[model samples]
Target: MRIVDVCAFYTPHGGGVRTYVEQKLRIGPQLGHEIVILAPGDEDGVVERGPNARIVTLKSPRFPLDRKYGYFASAEQLHGALDALAPDFVEATSPWRSAGLVADWAGAAPRSLVMHADPLSAFAYRWFGQVFSRRTIDWQFSVYWEHLRRHSRRFDHVVCANSDLSRRLAEGGVPRTVTLPMGVEPGRFSPLNRDPALRARLLAACDLPESASLLLGCGRLSPEKRWPMVIDAVNAAGQQSPIGLVMFGEGRERRTILKHIAGNPHVRLFEPERDRETFARILASPDGLIHGCEAETYCMAAAEARASGTPVIVPDGGGAADHAGDGAGMTYAACDPAAAARAIATVLRSPRRQPQEARTITQHFAELFALYEDTRARVRMAA
Candidate 1:
């Protein structure tokens, strides 16, 4: 089978989306499938992965807010590209204007809208939360949800990354939404990777001693992530126990998050881990993973942490909660620093939970391709 993914948010230096797509391209051949990506780039070119997988880059304008990414202006190029690829299955990972472009394409392939992020929860609520009440924000979100429903109906299927999005879509009368949980890389992170020396080093970086609990926070430092709340929770926990937090990632909210952690000697900020192996080892060494974001779509970092046999403390809501699974973690009420602090202390004091079973990248590809094959057969029968 041949599959083509049209993604507008995928940049040269993107985070989870990029990682997911690259893994698919790299692993598709093992399942006897061909995959290609149609994405916005600085210049039009083809980046070859192997004989059957590659990325087709189309020149497009830069995303103003973050120049690292680009946005699709029109469907003309994408429409032409889809016609050329003539894939058996097509996927639009972007929910922006590109969604409409994919919807308008007159292609024979069965298409799906791979909902990677929740606009209402991740953007609308976070951006307007201060100005509007929860009820008001949800009511206003109905407008955006309605807009999505229109375009989503154009595709054969709508797949969500987590249960939070699936429930939201179901509540909005889009019951066909399927929840396809993403997988973490196998072998890259494991219980065996835990290093005592590395754990001590991380604790020392936070000005903590050997007895301190080293908690890991990995994600973009942004307002939506609520890093300030995380720092406050860690500080509050530090008052009662030997706990420290070492955050890994950089973003626009760096200054704000840094200021929030300035008075707390137990919290330290670090840049994102560039090397996957080293990152995985460090992840395994942490006593636990503490997350503050309540609007995550898939929470890949938390999944990686769990795969590393590190317990995770996430909000009771959102995709992160789902990633925490049944055994490797616990959840606190959303946006409550005291609750989060208490949860953190509890997790740090308890014995580490064994790593739960996680879907591997190969397994994700196999399941996704089977879905595509089924969707394609249905489309053919309908036609």
Candidate 2:
């Protein structure tokens, strides 16, 4: 089978989207498939991956707000490539204007819209939460929901990373919305890699002893991440007992997040870890993963923390909450610092839970390809 993915978020320095696409390309050939990625780049070029995979880049202008990424503007170039490649299956992984570019293409290939993020929850709600209520925001964004429903109705399937997103889209009348949870890299993180010395050193960095509790906050430090609330919760919890938060991430909101963490000695933000082995050790070393974001489509960092045998403290709602309470996890009401602080203290005092089985990215691709194959067959039969 031959499949093509039209993705605009696959940038050189992108986060989750880039990681997911790279893993799919790596595993496509092993599943007896040829995979092609049609993406916007600095120039038109092609990079051949092992044998059955390649990336076709088209010259494009920088995206608004973030210059690190680009958008698809030349419909002719994108459609021309799809015409030439003639893939059996196609996927548009971004919900931006580029998605319409893919949807407009006259390819006979059955297509899917695999969501990269939940704009309504991640952006709209976070941007206006301080000023408006949830019902008011939903009413204001009714046009956007209708827009999504209109476009997604054309695709064979609307793939979501979590049930919350799938349910929302389905409720908004998007036909064939399917939930397929993403998977973690196998052997990349484990409780066995937990280092006592590293934990002690991290605690000491915050002027605390080995007995101090350490919490890990891993994600892009954007406005939507709600890092300020996490910092406040940690500070409040630290007042009662020795506690420190080590956040690992780098993003456009670094300065803002740093400002929010200012005057708080127990919370520190660090650059994203590059080496997988080193990051795995650091992840497993933390006592618990404390997160404040309540609008994630699927929180991979929380999954990694649980897979590492570390307890978790997440908001009461969102994708991350789905994995809570399975082992050593606790959920507090969203946007409540006092509740978060109490939850943190409870998790620290609770008995340690053994690491649960982590799903592998390879398995994810295998299942995804099977679904693509089935969709292709169904589309051909209908034609």
Candidate 1 stretches greater than 4 Å from native: 130-135
Model 1 pairs in collision: none
What is the C-alpha local distance difference test score of each model? 0.85, 0.86
lDDT of model 1 at position 60: 91
Best by lDDT: 2
Question: What are the per-residue Cα lDDT tens digits for candidate 1 across 35-150?
Answer: 89999988899999998999999989999988999887768887888898898888999777888898899987888888877777777777887789967887877767676889
TM-score of 1: 0.96
- CA RMSD of all predictions: 1.5, 1.4
Residue-wise C-alpha lDDT for candidate 2, range 192-263, written one tens digit per residue: 989999999888877678988999999997887888899989989988888989999988789988888885
Model 2 CA lDDT for position 315: 88
The per-residue C-alpha lDDT of model 2 at residue 335 equals: 81
